[model samples]
Target: MSNPGSYPLPDRFDAVLAEQDAEGYRCRFAPVALSDLPDRDVLVEVRYSSLNYKDALAVTGRGKIIRQSPMVLGIDLAGRVVSSGSSRFRPGDAVVVTGQGLSETEWGGYSPWQRVRAESLIPLPPAFSLAQAMGIGTAGVTAMLSVMALERYGLAPTPRPMVVTGAGGGVGSMAVALLARLGYPVAAVTGRAALHDYLTQLGARQVLDRSALAQASPALGNERWAGGIDSVGGKTLAYLLAHTAAHGAVAACGLAGGADLPVTVFPFILRSVGLLGISSSSTPAAAQTQVWRRLARDLPASVVDSISRVEPLSRIFELAEEILAGGVRGRIILDVRA
Candidate 1:
């Protein structure tokens, strides 16, 4: 491996920065000085970052994902450590950072180089290359965490299918692929009918129309899924809960569809359904490591490639708009060096 000192570092690097303006928020590709980065334990030469729903929100100003202004707008990044103040990491060490207040309270991975808290870094597993790690990124981590949560709640592979809502999106795509790889049948739900083949190619046994589950469901409906991973909240989540089998669990992660859950406690009280809320942003580093390991072991590289595509960091604004409009099919890996 090449030492960090072997490569000449740039004084200024390109970054997608979001700044608060009178109109609200505006994102642009700006040159940021290396000295401007936060004083953290590690300085990473970020090679790749991945766009998630949260990133789209931050970049497009569609949601309040950034707690501070003039923030870098990427939630997931993978790269090599250029310098480290902590003993846990060394120069040239591969690392990945997802969440940990990134693009929120802290400067994030949209930059070609970023200073990150050492505790926020997970040594990249041997099973994945840096690009592949970002391909999985935050979306894959959330999916693995959701699967782990479901198992911890007593769910397992069974004849009954596990439904994944918003299946064309990053989190939902990862969830479907992970669940299917682990031997669970998956019913992939999406509003885009064109993604049927795409979802099936990712190992979904069934492709469900999102409209079927987007309606306000009864308090308790006929049990259908053994469980589910719902990235779309609101009516979609309500439907998933109402139809979940007894003692089954549904992991709720995102609110792309809406925020409110318009359903009674009948599903919980009557059928003992489990509602597991998955928040990857605040997950402990140790837990994040475990989730990444699980992803490396279970999620196929081909699936990752199929579900994600590489794009230059320069096009982030247009890409962010596309993602917010639900035009993006899956994960968008940003090549910071490009």
Candidate 2:
């Protein structure tokens, strides 16, 4: 492993840069001068970056994920700080960066080197390697946040299963694994039958077909799940809300399926069900620290390793397309070292 500030520093490095114009948008792997990075308080030598759904949208120009162009396209990264003007961090400190509008309004983690705001960086947990940290990425952070909501809201692990929608994807897989590892019975829902064994390996107690939960549920259906972590919004959220046990909470994260909630307020009013919205991006540093601590303690290393795979930076373009089309499974980490 390369120690912080030990590797010969490169004044320029390869990065996936996205640019947009009236004609359209284009993204390519190219060398970027270190001096050109957005001015910030800390400079990190990013070792690993991860491909998330947001990254896919930003890289493919399929969605408005990037607020500015000619920016890097990775939402999460783990590395060693090489230099810092901020007193909060120092050279050789292992760090992880996610959210904080990264790859959106700011340069992000798709490169071997990046300048990041000091406030957005967290000390990587001692238990995790840089690869493991990037494996967790923003998706895993979001999952941990969702589980934190459920636990903090007084929904403890019980015999009654918790439903995790979009179980084949990054966030969903992480959620299922984290929940199950914490003694919660997890019912993972996925559209791809091919990933049944994969989800099972991640600790899902049971796997449900996506269609089983996509149909509109009655205003107040039979309470099936004790709690729910929903990544696929729209109908799946509606179903989870309708079938959630009384007083149970549902943490809604992503809007992969659709955004509109085509359901009435019956679930809330009748069942006293609570819906908590999760935003991994823009999370306060204090909260992010708490979540990362919980993740370090609760998420087993085997589970994290089982749910992610590595891909070199060169394969990112095709990986982005697969992720956008819902064809990819698990997390994809990009090895940025060249």
Candidate 3:
């Protein structure tokens, strides 16, 4: 069946909505009508969306990721412009909308229909399908940015390993895949020995256990890494700092482990190690465009399929439970129209 005044809809328009339960947490979506959507500048008929750790937390009510009640839960949306009020885009324009507080401060892309602010819209990269763009999503963008930061600081082909903490997770996996595709020797750090094989397939030449770093104190440790992409934060970052080779760089993201880093100044003071902070929120538009272009050109075609898991919007409630429990693998792309 066609939607009342927008794109085609089947018998139902699938979406994931979160509501606060008296007991604790709850999420579900009924057959939402298009006319029932909140008003905004551009009405996007979302075809595909993707999850990040933030989306997981928002769906579960575990962290305060969602600021409003009865919210749709999805952070990244890739879809066609069903209609638009802005001059910049018109009907049928492909777009990637992400990280403008979707599923957090506002209703987001879990719905098949969404009203997005036109200014937040980004035209899809020419090299990607709408689904493929969502498959990469915010995680891939952040990963590319981290790798870009390292490359900016002279991460070259060297005998020393470039360690990636939390290598089994989304950003870490993409980082591993991107770095390896670019001819860097990547060492993935994960406590899950089982994912060693999986990480290896994603381009990690070696895998290190998280606990091995926990026992070592780091004014300086083994001059192990040429550089690193540390997504786990906390002690993992401290360890990476201690272990990075002389004059090496590390792009610090995520706080999966914890935010606290108990460290001394030895790595920076003695080794001239560089700790580069890669932030997505304040990244310049031109730089963002540059990074996306790099990802389109360099990320292997196989990596899109290799690092992604597909799920329906209705499954997000359960998916969040798994993410919080640290049981999810790779990138999980949400099929919003299903």
Q: Which one wins on lDDT?
A: 1
Model 3, 96-170: lDDT tens digits are 876777887767888888888887788888888877787788888889999888888877878788999888888
> 142-163, model 2: which lDDT tens digit per residue?
9999998888789998889999
* Model 2, residue pairs in steric clash: none
By TM-score, the candidates rank as 1, 2, 3
Task: Write out the backbone clash pairs for model 1.
Answer: none
Model 2 CA deviation exceeding 4 Å by range: 1-6
**Candidate 3 residue 305 C-alpha distance from true site, Å:** 0.8
- Going through the candidates in the order shown, the clash numbers are 0, 0, 0
- Which lDDT values do the candidates have, in the order given? 0.91, 0.89, 0.81
- lDDT score of residue 241 within candidate 3: 93
Which has the higher lDDT value, candidate number 1 or candidate number 3? 1
* CA displacement after TM-score superposition, residue 52 of candidate 1 (Å): 0.7
